[model samples]
Target: MLVVSTGDLMMFGISAVALIVLAYVIQKTRLGRALRAVSFDRDTAQLMGIDSTRIIQLAFVISGILAGIAGVFLGIKYTLYPTLGSLVVKGFIASVIGGLGSLTGAVIGALLLGILETLLLAALGSGYSTIAVFAVMLVFLLIRPQGIAGSNVQEKA
Candidate 1:
């Protein structure tokens, strides 16, 4: 049987709320618009007087802050070790599975990966479950490299 603690529930709630707030900030703010523009095309954003350099800097700062917060949350939930950073591979896999640049896609991919991993672990064992997750990611790469929510974007010359 599976058991969940209040700490786990609180963590889930905090994570969900954080994601929602981030989505809102990305979708509905002037900073968000500038960020999207700069990310899409730095040259064009600069040409349009959007201060691409500043936006890029801000982006990095924001990412660093988020990463730090995530690290703290992770430490709260699990033991810290030198090898703990290796688990970031799962985040990479989830992002790729959902589509690289899409936040919603990443969330969906994470949930799907978690569900698949949990089911496999329950049925089989940890060894096979890890292999199966990798296999699933391989299939996604081969079949739909753009990911579930990613659209093919043509680069300008």
Candidate 2:
């Protein structure tokens, strides 16, 4: 049987709120616009007076902060281990499944991955979860390499 505590619910709430705020910040603020502009075309953004270097630095800092928060939550949920960094592979898979640069895609992909892993574990066994997840990822890559929300564009060489 699965058991959930108030703490878990609270943490989930906090995570959801943080994600919403992040989405808003990325979608509605001038800084967000600048960030998006820098991502889309750094040279053009620089020509328009956006400091690409500063924007890039800010993005890194923000990513670090978010990662720290995630680390804290992960530590609270699971005992910290020296090899916990290896779990980044799951995150990479989620990103690939969702689409590399789409925040919404990442979230959806993560949720989908979690659901699929749980179902696979229940149906097969814990040992099969990783294999199943990777198999699904491989299938997705073969069928839709751009991911659920990514666009496929040919780049000029």
Candidate 3:
């Protein structure tokens, strides 16, 4: 059976729009700036009059909402299964590839991963696609452990 359908395309469009909106909110809103400040340093943000706890709570709520949306979409696309939670590996890989904490990186990484997976599936079959993806990720980590959008920093031990 074909996996791609009109419904899937519609869902993909909706997801894309949602992601774009989220990225914009994270990049251009006051809450986003506060979140960034908190992420950079909670103590400093607190000193600057930002409520770190509130920001953290808001972040958790936003994360939960997004996760719920993703879960619903996944259920609709692939149906509920015992191993559904394991599918998060793709998101983890994409996040790693794009850059651990960068919104733009995550979006780019996911898009690139999706394209790569589709190409690999067509060329090497489904069995080998995951292997190739992981192999590529390993090579990427070996060469650029900071990820595509992550900046290199020297940490003092």
Q: Which regions of candidate 3 fall more than 4 Å away from where they truly are? A: 1-4, 153-157
**How would you order the candidates by lDDT, starting with the best?**
2, 1, 3
TM-score of each: 0.94, 0.93, 0.90
Error of 2 at 122 (Å): 0.7
lDDT of each: 0.89, 0.89, 0.88
lDDT for model 3, on a 0 to 1 scale? 0.88
Evaluation by TM-score, superior candidate among 1 and 2: 1
Which residue pairs in candidate 1 collide? none
**Best model number under TM-score:** 1
lDDT tens per residue, model 1, 97-127: 9998899899999999999988999998998
Off by over 4 Å in 2: 153-157
Tell me the deviation in Å of residue 53 in model 2.
0.3
> What's the best-to-worst order under TM-score?
1, 2, 3
Which digits, one per residue and each the tens of the lDDT, describe model 2 over residues 1-157? 7899987898899889889988998999988999999888888999999999999999999899888888888898888889888689999999889988899999999999889988999898988888989999999899999899987744533
RMSD to true structure for each model, in Å: 1.5, 1.7, 2.5
* Candidate 3 per-residue C-alpha lDDT over 1-157 given as tens digits, one digit per residue, 9 for 90 to 100: 7677898898889888889888888899999999989888788899999999999999999999999889889878896889888779999889879988878888888999999999999999999998999998998799988789977744533
Q: What TM value does model 3 have?
A: 0.90
